[model samples]
Structures are given as C-alpha cells and as structure tokens.
Target: MGMMDTLDEWHSIYIKAGIALPGALLSARFRDEGSDEQKMGLLLATALACLLACAAAQNNNPTENLALRGRATQSSTYYNYVFGYLASAINAIDGNMDSNFYHGSCSFTNNDMSPWWRVDLLKSHKISQIVVTNRGDCCGNLIDGAQILVGDSLENNGNNNPSCSEINYLPNGGTQTFECNGMAGRYVNIIIPGKETYLTLCEVQVFGVPVSKKPPCS
Candidate 1:
C-alpha cells in the first residue's frame, strides 16, 4: 500500500479511539497491512517524529551569516581599489584594516553627497538582524549617522526602505548588529544622509530565512 493510505488508516484508528488529528487533515492513499497493535505503534512513532522534527526546526535559527551568497555594491566607487572592494566586502577576508582597503578585504565608497552601500540577496527574506563591521583605521567615524534600511524596493538605492537602525557611533574596528525583528526585504542598505562622506565596511553579515507566502500546511 502507499504511504498516504497507511497514514489514513492510522488516522482512522486514532480517531475511533478519540486520540487522533482531525479527519479533515487525512488524505487517503496508503493502506496498512500490519496487525492493529503494530499499526498503532508505527503511527505513534510517526507522530512523535513529527513533533520532534518541528521542535528541531524551531531550534535551528539562522546562526550562520546568510549574506555570503549575496552580491554587494555601493552608490559610487572610489576607483582606487581595482580589487572590487565594494563587491567583495560582503564576505571579505580578514585584514589589518589600516592597509588592506585596496585589496577587497574592505569596501570604500566615494565622498558622494549621500554615500550608500547595498547588498542584493536575490530573493526576499524575513530578516532577523544584520551585523556590520567598521574599518579599524582612521576614518571609521564617517559611517556615523548612517541609516540601515530593509525593504523590497530599489528606489533611491533602497534608501526608501523602512529604517531598522540609525548608527550614531562605531568605535574603530568595531562591529555592531541591528535587530530587524523579522522585517521582510530583499535589499539591505546603509547610507549617511545630508553630507558627503566615505562609507567603508569591513564586512556585512545578514541573518534570516527565506520569505514565503504559502500556507504552512502545504
């Protein structure tokens, strides 16, 4: 018999004993050929497994950074770094921070009127939080007043997205994480408004799961 048929038979048995899930959830396909007691034991095991699976999934939060798979860019490049520092900084290798700005181990944007940097995750996600690393060298303070934005829109270089945090200060070589609280977005942006300044980043790490609209029952 098919798996679904067996599941349905077990469902029926549980229902008759007043201990089963609702009948509407059962889809007939599998058939059970084992003895009734064996069937009950198997069903009980399956139910326990399902419950354990759900608990495990809940515990498997996004501990590892999810931005390593994404692409990075800034509003404007400094043209001094041929190694694509802005593009490689999302998951850049460690650097001394003082001398590695041109090697793609960090990102540097030009002194534009509103310097910005962004990451394209390629798909929407329920963003939980973002960790941003600042350059350890002399000018890390340039990122002050930067706004962290998260949303699906690309307008204004994603600056139009809802703000998750406004960075006031970051010590040299400091790392700060802003909790987004499950904000939905595909783009993550950082910008300093109303003035020209450099936006250098040592690393950007995003944590979250893929966004879905489908029903959980499916």
Candidate 2:
C-alpha cells in the first residue's frame, strides 16, 4: 500500500487501542481512574487541533516572486546612462522579442561634443514606438537624430558608419516621446550631434507593435 494508506491504517489501529490502553494504565496506578472514552476523546481532539495548526502554518508561509524595481529619483546620488539588450525589457508584441525579467537596462545620454550611443539589436526587430523617461528632473540628453543600422556590423573604430539611416529627428529639447514609423533594423544609433547642455539620461523604453498600412475601419 502507499505510505499515506499505511499511516491511515496505523492511526486507526492506534485510536482503537488508545480507548482502553490509557485508562487501563491509569486504573493500575489509581484506585478509580478516569473513563477510557473521555481519555480517547481528549486525545482525538488534541490530534485534530494539531493537524489544523500544521495546515494553517503551511498556508501562512508564502513564497514571494522577485523582480526588478525602479530606483527613486528624488535621491541626490547620480547615475550614468546605460543602454543594451539587458537594460530594457523586450516588449515586442509580435512575438519578436523577449520580456525583461529585470527593469531599466536601456537609457539615453547627453554628451556635449560628439554625443552618440550605439545599440546592437543583433537581429532585425520591427520597432514602431519608443518611450523615453528622464532619469531625473532637469536631466536629459540632447537627441538630434535616431538611426538604425541593418545587418551585421559593430564599428567602434571611430568611423561614422555609412549604413546607419536616420529614423527620427529632433532639432531641440522636449523630445521625450518618439513614435517610429515601424522601422526594421539590426543596430540602432542615437546621435547627439550638437553642442547641447550638460547631458543627463534616465531610461529608454522601446516598444514594438505590428505595423498596419490600412487605416482603422468605421
């Protein structure tokens, strides 16, 4: 039989034997002992209460799922900009990318000189929307242009890559939201091509949805 079945059988035999065993031992010691039924009833109640207590304890012990949380911006400490595949959560709805189990891996930058950041998507991803959030108030990078490079290449040799094509443009500040035209690309490059103010960045959010040519039907 199963272990549970054996336990149940043993418990049944114990309960049966307990009816007379406790009272018989007590009667041997005392002249007139308490009733066996009362002793058996008390033991059964205690056993039931202990089983319920164990069940309650198991229920109270719950496991919490761990995930990433954003850092508080109000703090005075400064954090440098960062952007990579591991930085931002992959939120492509077309089954093209994977979700980021952690948060805030992607970010923008503000460099006064030849300010630019390169992101190698490695493979072509049809991206349509990008949401940018400043890491702190009065802290943001001047984003003059956004481009995407198609195919396999990572030119960190200080050579301005020719294959990179501009996908979005912002001549001045107030550029937190960028809705791309559903551009397909492998490598994405953001150009801070101007001598803007002190650069600051918080987070960069890339969202991908299916590109639809036809307008909404009435």
For model 2, residues 112-162, the per-residue Cα lDDT tens digits are 354444444435445554544333232222333443333234554222443
Which numbered prediction scores highest in TM-score against the true structure?
A: 1
Tell me, by lDDT, which candidate is best: 1
**Could you report the Cα RMSD, in angstroms, for every candidate shown?**
8.1, 20.0
> What TM value does model 1 have?
0.70
Worst-scoring 10-residue span by lDDT in model 2: 66-75
For model 1, residues 1-218, the per-residue Cα lDDT tens digits are: 66566566555544433344534335322355656765566567657545544444444446656678777778776655454334334433232233335445777777788888888888998888898888775677887999999999999879899998888998778888899988999999988988878888777788888887321112
Q: Once all C-alphas are superposed, what RMSD does model 2 give against the true structure?
A: 20.0
Query: Which residue window of length 10 is worst by lDDT in model 1?
Result: 91-100
Local error of candidate 1 at 26, Å?
26
TM-score to true structure, per model: 0.70, 0.34
